[model samples]
Target: MSEPTAPQVPAIPTARRQALRQHLMNEVTRPARRPQRMLVLAPAAAVLAVVVAAGVIAQPWAPRSAPLIVPVHQGEHVGAPLLLNQMAVAAADTPPPGEGEYVYIRSRVAVAELGDGPARLGPAYEREIWIPRYERGDGLLRQPFLELPVIGVIPDRTTLPDMPPNAEVVDLPGDPDELLAKLHRERDERGRGSSRDGAAFTAIGDLLRESLLPPPTSATLYRAAARIAGVEVVRGVTDAAGRRGIAVARTEQGRRDEWIFDERTFEYLGERSYLVADTADGPAGTVLATAAVLRRAVVPERGQRP
Candidate 1:
């Protein structure tokens, strides 16, 4: 019998490829908020062939099996504004990534999974990503396989195309008030969250997570977050890696999302989300997710470390 040949796949255009990369990255990096219908990534066979040939499997969006729930440690609400000001000063002191370098971030994250039974959080997993300083350069993402099977084989690495910068992170004005207004407008247009204030807070955290922002821009983000209503301070909170820090948080609907910072230095540490009121997903004070940033630095290449 003759050997079978591989199917030919058409080359994806630059614009389309960029859009695909953005969609995949957003799905991979963002935390799942609630139990919802999963959107299966079943593109045309030709596109799927190209993606698989590039050593990247579209992550399955199936409902995850419930794991153990982490307990939430509550704290008082005072000095949130003052703490944000201190964080803004610290963020401004950090230098931005140089041109032609990659921003490397190593983190430990445990995301909550909700099934038919109850909501639970999975074990913490280490995730590393290399983002190019320029939008034209390729990037890399490395993490262990989840419990669920992906295409019947486990994948530990994914090669990502050059992703365009987020407009809110890259183009917003430095003035805090103007920046906040723009975020609110964009959030409303996208219809992201239940309230405008909650959407703005989530947007700021998303910008901080995987992207490297300019020093002034980072400072502006913290200042803008401070302006959002319902922001409060939570003390003595621990991240996924068990690092203790203070947090600035906001409660919307039934969940509270917190951005943790070093108590003394006011440096960014990580973030966590938990329930404040009992719901069908889980009980009050049930932790939904937790993440801790272990290291961040500028590297010369995609796979290089500091």
Candidate 2:
């Protein structure tokens, strides 16, 4: 019998390939809030500085029992520059996990109705990702639901670049302008005809949501987000988990997409999308998607929840 030829893998456009890799591996920023869903155990001391610095703060003379910061008043807003800077500073202070471990994420998603029907809520799910420290093209991904199989055997950047077997998400530019230019270049490479501001906003959100990058990298992402045009602060928006927080959002194609953060500390909470104008398939005010990230942590192996 004749020998079989190996399958050819398509090549990803250079810029987009870079973006996709960054999107996946750099997904978590901090652990989830609730006790039952908590995956990683962070020392109270580790987060104390961040909690005090980022969140609302009480007067020094105030009783020791005082809360860290005052709750956000209705209609309060934070400018893009301020918000991003704050997040960046906090991210810069966060500690990175040790090597040779897997990043775990637990989340709940709510899918919206398009045509005058009620929205649908999807069950919570978990994702496990193993990023190799020294091995190239050996990244592993396993979803802890529906018996999804392991990935990363393939090394093609085009056909399965999103599932690339390499931990290629590090060393992102820390400069906001440089990062913005990079995203713009990638958008241009992909020939995206939409508003560059919209593209940048979406790219930043995707970056923040998908990857728990190094603090400095995460900070750089927030700063890059501040440069997007049409970005604004929205008050009183709630995440899928019903936690109310302010949002940084952009309107494109008659829909507003938002990244929500805690009202007090400004820690990233979740994200949501809703119609600003009626669409062909849905009315104005129709929501599209809402998600709450419950937890993220490094675990010892696959099939581990925390």
Candidate 3:
């Protein structure tokens, strides 16, 4: 009786309190019918804005997936990658020709002939080729032992009549993919029925043999060859000049083509071809052709020997 008693109120349980709070929140957040139109219009506007942004984002400079063409991996042959890398290094280390000079190359060549009866080995002869420093100049070819003219005449072979105009050594692409694509395009244009990849490899071999390229360009050629499929490691190959080395080879329909390199020095020694199957040119296992480079230098004149 000392103080006026106030009415007692029961405390709500945890569950009831949570439910009341949720109910209040829902009631406060509930949209009025009058505002529903605005809510619907706002979502539509937002969607339209998103679509417009998407269209703007679709640009040519946008990030894209990587190319589908996979690079060649080091496979069962462990030495393949190492050999190719070594060649690339050696190529980079090599020197290029000076201005107003000719590139001189000395080599030995041997070919086999398949007659109506059987295959016969042809004579192995020493040959020298001289190419001008310029892109579209004539080149000289001669055999000194045969007592040819002092000023060697430019041979028709050095002109690469079979290849396209742009397939010249100086015009070849420095990038691997571009080189390959060019090769394919040329083959198609020439109406060649051979395997495009195999033809590409052969074309690379021709470029390496018949011309003198800059160090960077030579390295690019080696890297490009490594990317081609069907190339394999051939151990214990001896070139025509009796230089022993490892080889990178490929077996096509009837021939096994090899590009030999010094095992330790990684210098390109030579290239050869052997019959894998009986063909009109030779029988199986016959050596179709062999070439070993003996010297390479820059000279003052086309016929001048280095």
Candidate 4:
């Protein structure tokens, strides 16, 4: 007798396909509860399975969704120069990492999902990075859990290139003016962002976030930021970890980027970005991104923690 043929499943209907796509998109933009433990990174095969199940093509470089509108809270206006000066003092006391050491930073972070739809904030996730002290040294990035449909699945841990993201220069000038000029020149060379001052402010923030700068260099960065035209102080700000503090901020292109500091100690705590006005990406007062630095220390190896 001939063998029986296997059953064939029917194809999904067009209407059902649309509904499924919408539902998956909504789920991707929904806010996620804070995870108690770090989740294991999914392998490439698993990630591919998810994409196939969703019936959507992955575009890692494209925007996933718009930012979600959040409650707006007004802050007290203060002198940016004074707050930045205090931060400079605090930064001056930080010791730089020794040679053959890595600067380890662990943080809780969230960012906006840019895509076709109303604005929404991506879920908060933990991120850890080991930045090498010397140039041409290997680094590492550990992001075990993140709901980033646009960027696709990120490996739990990955080796970094010679110059890691947001930290290109290991050494910098100690003079504020020189640092400011240098930042502007680099920004111009890259042709990034809209305004020169805004780019400089952003570059300073990027450097502050991931690198362990020398005491003088760190101090100079804050002093240099103070010289930016739109720099100001915003009070009553909170980071992703729910730590309340004041912020040194600058508004550019309908967004306000803030560097939060502890209220009592004036120590740098984290950074936040929010929408200043209603736009295509989201409504006014939407939080585009937020991060809180949980730990920073010097480690002898890439995977080791202090």
TM-scores, one per candidate: 0.74, 0.63, 0.64, 0.72
Q: What is the lDDT of every predicted structure here? A: 0.64, 0.52, 0.55, 0.63
**Candidate 1 to truth, TM:** 0.74
Better of 1 and 4 by TM-score: 1
TM-score of 4: 0.72
For residues 84-199, what per-residue lDDT tens digits would candidate 4 score against the true structure?
88888987887655554677888787655443334455566777877765544667777753333333344677666553321335356678898778767765765744477876
Candidate 4: residue 147 lDDT (0-100): 35
Measured on C-alpha atoms, candidate 3 has an lDDT of 0.55
Q: Write the per-residue lDDT of candidate 3 for residues 245-291, one digit (tens) a residue.
A: 87887777766778888888777788877766666544566665577
Worst 10 residues of 3 by lDDT: 31-40
After superposing candidate 3, which stretches have Cα over 4 Å from the reference? 1-82, 144-168, 278-283
lDDT of 2 by residue, 3-94 (tens): 53322234556675555434322322222111221112222111111111111111121122211111232222347678777778887888
Q: In every candidate, how many clashes are there?
A: 0, 13, 0, 11
Using lDDT as the measure, which candidate wins?
Answer: 1
Against the true structure, what is every candidate's RMSD?
9.8, 16.4, 34.6, 11.1
lDDT of 1 by residue, 193-230 (tens): 35777767776776666566788888888898888888
Clashes of 1: 0
Q: Give the Å shift of residue 107 in candidate 3.
A: 1.2
Error of 1 at 282 (Å): 1.6
Q: How many backbone clashes does candidate 2 have?
A: 13
Which candidate order results from sorting by TM-score in descending order? 1, 4, 3, 2
**How well does candidate 4 match the true structure, expressed as C-alpha RMSD?**
11.1
